[model samples]
Target: MLWRGRRQSDNVEDERSDTGGSGGFGGGSPGQFRIPIGGRTGGGSSIFIVILVVLAGWYFGFDPSQILGGGDSGGQITDDSGSEGGGAGAPASDEMKQFVSTVLAETEDTWKGIFQANGLTYEDPKLVLFSSQIRSACGFASAAAGPFYCPGDHKVYLDMTFFQQLDQQFGASGEFARAYVIAHEVGHHVQNLTGILPKFNNMRQGMSEADANHMSMQVELQADCFAGVWAHYTAQKGILEQGDIESALNAAKQIGDDTLQKKMQGYVVPESFNHGTSQQRQTWLARGYKSGKLSDCDTFNNPI
Candidate 1:
């Protein structure tokens, strides 16, 4: 969490001010749609209105995958698809952007070292910061979808506002908690590179919903362990301060499938758990943090 005064990556593409461009909300919709733009009204309300329009478009029938150069849309969708949010002369709405970049850079350094020891190459993944919604290689994603990693592009998409909700709504504050969230997504990228993802996808093809969920729980727990591994390295690098691990552990517990489900839906469904329980998440994360070994994170063979 001691991230300031460090190198900020040039890999970040600042589409935060580019509005009037292709790949706006309707670009991915079927039937060559158009976004209803308001005239030169310089007010905060305009941005909110635009966000609402985008949401409405999505709610009706907009599918980001269709027009985002995926299955159709006449090959308009390219690797550089979609735009980041905000307007001209506008700053990032929160400190999360800088924090995100720092965390990403830390992950890059940590993983690069780990991979070198294992005789493999580590490719850094792009982290996309958006406001309400985003168009990613995995298709259109709303902020409500939370942060996710898309193997299609090997990038992580996050709505920074989610951090606020995570603190106020989910009761997870502390910067390391936020870092843990980022690390979890990066963990998915690690799985993708290690061929674990393909195997899971293949197995899930014929699996029942319950069985698939069980496998998903294993995947998520492994990711948590990976996050702990990142923490271990950062701690060794003297990048972590006191109570950082505790904050992250609190976050791991806060966002567990069991805790979230019990809070949101007023019930718990064990068979529907994709992420493991709060205790399982905290324990596995602790295991990785303690051991700092990839071998220690074999969630598939070990009990949660």
Candidate 2:
């Protein structure tokens, strides 16, 4: 969590100023990114559509290229314009922006080393920082949808306000917890690079709603494990503090599908769960942290 004074990623994009219009697929202008928000129902295809649409871009692994056009496979970061922001229009105090960039840089370093060791090249992903809403290749997303990775654009979209929500609404606090959130989204980027996401999507084609949710859970749990893998490297480099792991674990527990559902509805529905239960999330994350190997994060082959 000792992030300040560390290296900040050049791939960080400040799109907070680009609010007020939407322009990608759903129509509007550049900054006016708005999407329909509806109440969550307990049954029928409406709920299924909502879940699919939300999960399509919700946590990870929906190829926006299939829906949005031209599939670009490269990992290079392109600016909203052609040139990079020399830190222009980043966070005002530079506190949150600096923290995010540092963590992203560290993840880049860690993943690059890991990929090289495995005889593969690591492609660094750009992190887009937006305000209330943003238009991604996947579609339009609001801050309420939380942070997500779009495989189509090869970018991680994050709304920093989610950090406040994590602390106030979800009861997950601390810098490491915030770092875990970034790492988890980056983990999805990793999965995309590994071709795991496409395979999962293909497999989900003929699956029932519940079955698809289970597959999605596996994908998300694997990302959590990848986050732990990043944490393992940070710990090895002596960057992680004493309570850092605990902070991340608490975060994993706090955002579990089971926990969130209970908080929202005062009950739990197992079949509708897509991100795994609290125990499953914590277990996968802990497994990666303890093992520090990509093979250990094979949530698809192993049961949760």
Candidate 3:
């Protein structure tokens, strides 16, 4: 993608070198509790219970990331009634920072135009470049949690190292693939603004485990489609290079529930699929790319 020399957003804040604050990992409101991914637990849990929670999460598709948060430590799932999280770390090079800002600026432009056409205003989400860990409105998060968008504060938190992993660990590379990651998270921001995220999240509370997994799949697929919509507009601007679309599609395939599961566990569990299969992800992404219209991204109502 021809992102350099393009408009760069001023909304990015880099906090990589600021890790020593808030007692290193356990600050925030008194009542705020975190669900650490696999960190130490204050209320120690046996590995058996940890395995159970992981199995439960896999079986019911209950959660993807609300597991290990921080300071108030545990390997179990925690309620979402907490404040932000994160710590200080190293920085990505200046060029990477520019790349991130440029991509974010493009998303701002694309979404703003779409929202205006739909008679709604667009709010630009703040993008934070942190190293290793960071605090977000949704609670504490580490780089292991990957890139995420927090609806509570309308900000996207990124650990740039994930880009390296996307290439080396997941075997997906190319700048546009990196851009797709950012856009996918930003898509969640769009869902939040559109009330789709809140509605679905609330609806999941009373839903059966399988039903909630289905709902979550819709939510995630729509975000992938939204990323494609962003790509659609981005391509029209003459910035997309040959094979750029394939790069993004490859990234989608690499990170699909089935692909990741097979890679990690050496087998597939169909019922635990909350993010759709590789073909489904690529299909939805391509569907949105075929038409830039937001109306084309009805993953919830249509068969995703």
Q: Which is the leading candidate under TM-score?
A: 2
TM-score of 2: 0.79
Tens-digit lDDT track for model 3 on 1-304?
Answer: 8876665666688888865234334433211111111112111110112222321212232221132222222111111322111113212347898788878877877776555544567898988888877876666666776777777788888888888888998889999999998898899888778776666555556666666666667767878988997787777667889999999999999888778778877887766667677888898899888865555666655765
| Candidate 1 lDDT | 0.64
By TM-score, the better pick of 1 and 2 is 2
> Over 4 Å off in model 2, which ranges?
23-93
lDDT by residue (tens digit), candidate 2, 98-129: 88987897888777656654456779899999
Better of 2 and 3 by lDDT: 2
TM-score of each: 0.75, 0.79, 0.77
RMSD to the native, candidate 2? Answer: 9.7
Give the per-residue lDDT of model 1 (tens digit) for 116-229. 544567787877776666676556655666777777778777767788887898888999998899899899888777766656665666677776667777777888998897
Q: Determine which window of 10 residues in candidate 1 has minimal summed lDDT.
A: 38-47
- Rate residue 89 of model 3 by lDDT: 23
Task: List per-prediction Cα lDDT, in the order shown.
Answer: 0.64, 0.69, 0.67
- Ranked by lDDT from best down, the candidates are 2, 3, 1
